[model samples]
Target: MIAPADHLTPDALERAQRHLVAKAIAEFAHERLISPERRDDGGWRLTVPLGDAEYLFDAVRAELDHWIVDEDSIRRLVRGTATDLDAQQLILELQPQLGLSDELLPLYLEEIASTLAGSMFKIAQGGPTADALADADADFQTVEAAMTEGHPGFVANNGRIGFGVSDHAAFAPEAGRPFRLVWTAARRSSSHLALGAGIDEEQLLSGELSAAERDRFATRLRDLGEDPADFHLLPVHPWQWENRVAITFAPDLARRDLVLIGESEDEYRAQQSVRTMFNTSHPHRHYVKTALAVQNMGFLRGLSPAYMRVTPAINDWVAELAAGDDTLRDAGFRVLRERASIGYTGDVYHRTAEPSAHRKMLAALWRESPVPLVSGSQRLATLASLLHRDGEGRSVVGALVRASGIPAAEWVRSALRAYLRPVVHCLLAHDLAFMPHGENLILILDEHVPTGVFMKDIGEEVALLSARTLPEDVRRIVSPVDDEEKALAIFTDVFDGVLRHLAGILHVDGVLPEIEFWRLVAETVDEHAAEHPHLDSLVDLRADSFAHSCLNRLQLRNTLRMVDLADQSSSLMYAGRLENPIGRARIPQPAARETVGG
Candidate 1:
């Protein structure tokens, strides 16, 4: 067994704190949460209201108001004396500026500490360098495990508050250890299972479990005085089963409404999204996503049972639409649909007035895995790996460009065609938009060049703003977004949320300049527009600027549930207008913009 405290070394903790502090400074500055004044030495200085506390760092003001701060150059000062670059302490120093309420300050601090600990764990593990991860021969899971950065935008991205050190070691995605899922049989009357088109319960079960394992679970149900035919089998995360279900639903277990079966025969590894698991033993099997009652990022990471009921239908609708569209099909884009889902209703939790963690504890969904989709020359990697940098500051994307033996500009263009082209087509042609962040995509690479992408987490993240007719069951995805803010699905979610970080990484790593990067993006959009002249005028890609929807601001206001998933538009927190890079790139330059940091 790995020691729980093995990774919590002093050196690792300090390094983690430094990197996190730099990220906090950069993101907070981008959101206009804090202003750092320019210094004579071409650096920036931020003096907080807290007694004699200030931060000094060298930074470049990139497009979209992104502050590309040098982590190594950061120095924390008090009374003109240097101190350790403590991330938690920096939060306290900037508490007044951050607009953290008295009630929310400590809770946010706990989350920061949790994020720091996760960073330390990753530092201690020290698996693969960015160069190795960039290789086409590297396994999909290896690249997933090597990723240290969670969400590039969110400072406290890894706040798994419910996890102890032991739980972190056993269940966190960074651990990358294979473990069997805890299986359970819930009485048919108290549970619901939804399957996608043409798939039956038997087919789902047979695919997930071997015949002997199925017989073992059925016999266990019989021994418990329950008929196997009268129950539905559910796979659960071991952490959730032990930490949440065992105690919270003890009554249901005693009443024989739910019975513990055996564990899964096939071992599974946790994906970047902690609740989701990939079948390592049987790579072709479906990915199982379980309800994890942990407070991570902005919400309690739980799958809703009510939402589960319509998941398959929503996925089915999206898949059929994608398959029939020639543009999307030609772009090599695919949606990894959630094929089946099962949720158990406990009697005690249903009595609550609102949807809480208790009510969301027992649901799980099986999404089609992207493993079998790749062939001989093709490999799978998380899109997040594109922004990854090793301890020595060598980037995975830079390594991939070198390995491909292609110019950085051409590689970026290929990436745009594979990733961004489909996204733009989906929005204009189909009136569909996905929350296509790094973690949500499986980037398909052929000999270190991006060929296509597999989009997952479909049921929760997809949005349909179209007025087109749809079946009643699939209407849940229809979001009534305002016309002006509609483009923000790409502008805010894609540009500021993802590409801004990638641009910074590429610029900093010396692979590509920020100006040329945005030029290629603008060129890609222009080319796509020329091809599809009958596109919807929902939002213009050539607009001067768009609303700056701030992620950290939402988290700062409500550390619990930042935004309701059902109506994401209503809860948006915006900073000011961000200058559109694409719009600027379209104009002929009188003078070339100088590269700042790189």
Candidate 2:
């Protein structure tokens, strides 16, 4: 029950505030949601609603309308007196301007506070500088841990909204605390377990839980007057069990429908996405993502029971496609499938409540870890890590590029093969769209040079945009969508959502000029278009431009009431169209090579 006081030092707190204030200014301005007047001194002034209060900061409105705001140069002026930045005060003052309704005001403020606190926790640890992280020579977790920023565009990215100070210390991913998960036995009648091809419960349990752990769990089940054979076993994040499951689903526990089976023998560490835990005890084992039901960003961060039914099938379908397609195989595109899953649906919640409300409270899925699949000396890092700046402001990607011993332009072509090629091909050939976000995509690098990509977290995120003909088993991946919106999955999700920030960071890091970066992207797209002429019927690159969907605006608009998100394309908020970066780029042809990675 100890608080994370050590991580929340005054210096760290102040640094967190300054960092987040910079984010608020950058994101709001970039989204074109706020109007800031340019000043003659090269500083921009954002006036407060209904008053004389103002915020002034030096920033370059760069490409894609990115606000490259300088953190140290930001200040607030009230009645002609200047003061240091305060994130909470800034958000409060801009609440009306942000269009944050009264209903979402208080919770939004709490998220901002939690985000700042999490940032401070990361800062207080005198971790490796960005230069060191760029080296890419550290342990896997060390490199992952060194990522200072959470979501690039999200101002309230680290909002672990459910955690108390004590919970934060014990369970926050940045804490790097390794602990055993509390296992459980849920009656088969009350839960659903889905397994992919050639796998069963015993196979999964044998790999994840040792014989001794299984026996111990069985004993706990027997002690509750139940046979282990009649129940399915699942691991629960200890903190989640204590804070949410124990209290929220007390009826099931008391009725002996869900029996506690003590801690597992294996240890796990949380990934940056708090609900998902990587099996540090066995690196090659499945990564278990559990439903914690914490409200973060805009809505409850819970895995849906509805999705669990088709989870394994969806992954299997996609994995088979990736393996069968010569293009996907040639590009070395891999999907770390969610091979198995178990979800609980309580009668109380099933009949009385919305599935999203309570049926989503308890669920877990096993996604194959990339460690075992990694070939040669190839290492895996989340795509987000590219933008990761260490304490000393060194980028992870910059270090990787430097280590490759190749020119920035050459290295970018290599990177394009690994990252962008697959995405464009996936949409054109397979009629599929992976979330394509940094958190969802893991980058595959060999000797710190781009090789290929291994994607995970598939069930809910990957969707079939054009389901011309799908196998009966794989039909679960299809989401109801129109042609125009389906195309945005590529445009908005991959290009603007991820590559915009990546290009900016690489430009800032001297890896590749932003123009050249987009040029590479455009070339990759054009190459894919040339390769897959038949898929021209499925998609069109000739559409003059695409919608610049507003991600922050979706959260702000839905903060009060989240739209029932049936599909990624269904509930969208587009600010306006920024001209396609790809269209503007003068495409470049690679020197003749056997592979794009060369």
Candidate 3:
């Protein structure tokens, strides 16, 4: 918990506050929550609801009609009075525009505060410039930590709600320190392990835990009035144990349904997405995704027991499909699968047919780490890294282009073909669409050029657009998606949610012209369409513009309550359709014919 730097210093705090204010202003505007008056310089200005306060910023209206604002140009004024930018007050000023309910406003403020603090911490833990990262051969963890912007869509992305300032300093991924995980024992009757094909309990336990460590865990269970064989061990996030499990699950502990075993000897580093931990101690061990009952981004991040039971089989189904496909095999697109999962159902919580955050409280899954899949010549970086910009305004995307020694557009084309083609193939050929956000996908770099991609973090959001029956084992993932909302998965999630920001970043960086950038994206989709015509005609319709489901609006509406993950497809809130930039780019505008003289 050592201070990364002078995090509390006035200059750092002001910078963090101002940065968030700018993001909030731009995001709210883009959501159509507010309309700022256009200024003569082509920038925009806003007077707060109370005429006492106002904000002025330079911004450009970009594709998807996003307000790409210049952070440095932001100015805040108050009652003919002014101070260095204040985000806390800005939240109150935009309260009407955001339309936050009274009950949720205070809680939302906490998220905003935590988010601002995270930005402050990042400022404190400054690292290599984008130029340096672009040129250097950085390891996965090194490059992961360098990523500055947390979720481009959400302004308050790092709101680790349950954490105190100290907890944030210790466990936040940006802290960049390894810590031991606390282990606990759940009685066999209270918990269950869902094994992957050919993976038994013994092999699973021994792989993640050494013999001596297993003995230690078993002995601790025996010391209590329980047989070691009657209980299964579960790893809990250290912060969760200290703040949640020990306090909230005390009754389970008293009945010996859950017993506190000591921390694991192996140290783990928190990955970019906070709850998932990378096994730093054993380089090739499975990455453990744990259930932390904290609100992050839009919902409670607790892993559902009902959902956990089916992860491995779903993953196996995906892997099997990929192996059988010639195009996917040749494309080199691989999924970093969730191979095994274990869940502990508290007797009280399991009484409910549906899963609330309470039922989701204690569970963990083991995702296959990219470590073993990685070779020495090949490197890995999260796709999110491309969005990172250093203090000098150089983007990681700019750096990667330079490092690859390829023309910017050429590098982008290869990266797009590697990423977009697989996603498109899965949709057209298999009726599957993954959650294609940055953190969910890993960039596979061979000698600084993106060779392929590894898709991770596929859960309920991986939609099945088809009504056709699936295998008995994998049927859990096959949900009926309406035609209207089917393309929203790819269009909203991939095109608008992810590529919108990427296009803006690259466009601003001058790495690619805006039209050419979008043209490449359109071309990639058209090529995929040309290759796969046998699947469904809807592919062309989906590739063209589709409905825009407003994701941030869902969070704003229900900040505290569970978004009802059980009925996930129904939970989305839509603000009407956004014209797909790539779709429009792909359509042919008829050429004008020359007139003949009489």
Candidate 4:
């Protein structure tokens, strides 16, 4: 048995705390929740206005006002004396400036410690060095499990609030353990199953389970004096079954409305998004994403049965859109459709709970895997891998660039063309936008060079801004945003949330300069605009600046539900304005190349 406290030594905890503190300082400062004054030694100093605590660090400001802090240079001082770098203490000292309410202070501190603990766990694991991960032999799932950073913008990105240390060791993505899922059979009357354009129950099940496995489940139901035909089978996270379902749904289990089935024969590894699991036993099989009641990031990570009802239809529509578009097809952009879903609704909670986590506990969806999409010598890596920095502080992207045997600028241009151009076209032509952050994208690489991208998380994150007509079942994706905020679908989500960090990584690693990075991005957008000049006015990419949508502020304001799914625009929190790097690159500067190269 693995000891949970083995990684909790003072050295590991201190290192993790320092790394998290650096991230908090950088992200909080970017969100304008804290101000760090520049010191004469080319460093930065942040002092609490209401307390005697102060912090000193060195960081370089990059595009979109990103703070590339040197984690080793961070130091904390209180009353003219040095103090241990504590992430929880940092939050407490900055509570007044953070605008955290009296009720939220304690919970926020807990999240901070949880994040720090996760960091400590990763440090203890010491899975792989950056160069080792970038080697040609590193497989797809290996990179996925080896990821250290959860999300680029969020400080408490790994706060799995409900998970104990043992649960963390078994289920967390960083744990990299393959485990089987618990299957349960819910009465057909109380459950719903939805399939995509060309899927059926038998066909989905045949691919998911072998004939013997299905027979085992059916025989188990028969032995319990229940007919298999009267129920639907759903796979659930093992932790949720032991902790939540067995205790909360005891009456349903007693009444035989929900029968406990056997575990899956195939094993799956957890993705960075904790609830989703990739089938390692059969790599070509569909990915299973189950409803996890655990609290992570800002909200309870639950899958609503209502959303499951329409998820496949929404995915089918998006798939059709991608297939029909010429530019998207030529760029080799693909959408991993949520082909099928099964949701179980327990009668007691469905009637009493008012659209909270209780109503969303027992649902799961199957997404397409990128394994079967590649052929020949092609390779697959999560887009998040490009942003990964190993324990030795070497970036995987730098290793990838070296392996590609291409100049850094040219390689970056290829990546932008493969990833960014398609996203731009989707927005300008169809007024369609998605949460295209790194974790949601799968990059198809040709020996370390990105040639295409596969976008997942379709049904949940897609936002359709056009007045285009849609099927009744697919209307759940028709999210209406204000005309002014429409551009933010690209600016805020892509540039600030994704590319800003990519640029910083490359710049910090000494691979590509920041100015050249944004210039290439602007060039890609310009080329797309030139092709369809009429659509250029739809999303004005040449704007001077855009609203600084603060992600950390959303969580700070309310950790329960950061944004309403039905109306996401209303919950946006903004600081001042962020100077658009693309707009800055568009200006006529003949000497800009010389400056970056020099």
Best by lDDT: 1
Q: Give me the displacement of residue 28 in model 3, in angstroms.
A: 1.4
Candidate 3, residues 22-83: lDDT per residue as tens digits? 88888777777778898898778888884478888898778876778899998877765665
Q: Which residue pairs show collisions in model 4?
A: none
**lDDT of model 4 at position 513:** 90
Off by over 4 Å in 1: 1-3, 584-598
- How well is each residue in 126-226 modelled by candidate 2, as lDDT tens digits? 67765565554656676665666777888887777778877776777777788788887788999989999999888988988889888888888888788
Candidate that beats the other on lDDT, 2 or 3, i.e. the better one: 3
State the lDDT of candidate 1 residue by residue for 1-598, as single tens digits: 6455888899998899989999999999999999999999889999987768889999988888999999889998888999988888888888888898889989999999999999999998887888899987899999998889999999999999999999898888889999999999988899999999999999999998999999999999888788999999999899989988889898998998989998999999999999999999999999999999999888999988888999999999999999998888888899999999999986678777876777899999999989888788999999999988887778899999999999999999999999999998888887788999999999999989998999999998898975667898788898867667778988998999889999988897788999899998887887888778687576787788888899999999989989988778889999889889987544432343356884
Report the error of model 4 at residue 91, Å: 0.6
TM-score of 1: 0.97
The order of the candidates by lDDT, greatest first, is 1, 4, 3, 2
Ten residues in a row with the worst lDDT in model 4? Answer: 586-595
Off by over 4 Å in 4: 1-3, 584-598
Question: What is the per-residue lDDT of model 4 for residues 269-306, given as tens digits with 9 covering 90 to 100?
Answer: 99999999999999999999998888888889889999
Residue 473 in candidate 3, Cα distance off native in Å: 4.0
Task: List the candidate 3 regions with Cα displacement exceeding 4 Å.
Answer: 1-6, 79-82, 352-355, 541-544, 584-598
Candidate numbers sorted by TM-score from highest down = 1, 4, 2, 3
What are the lDDT figures for the candidates, one per model? 0.90, 0.79, 0.79, 0.89
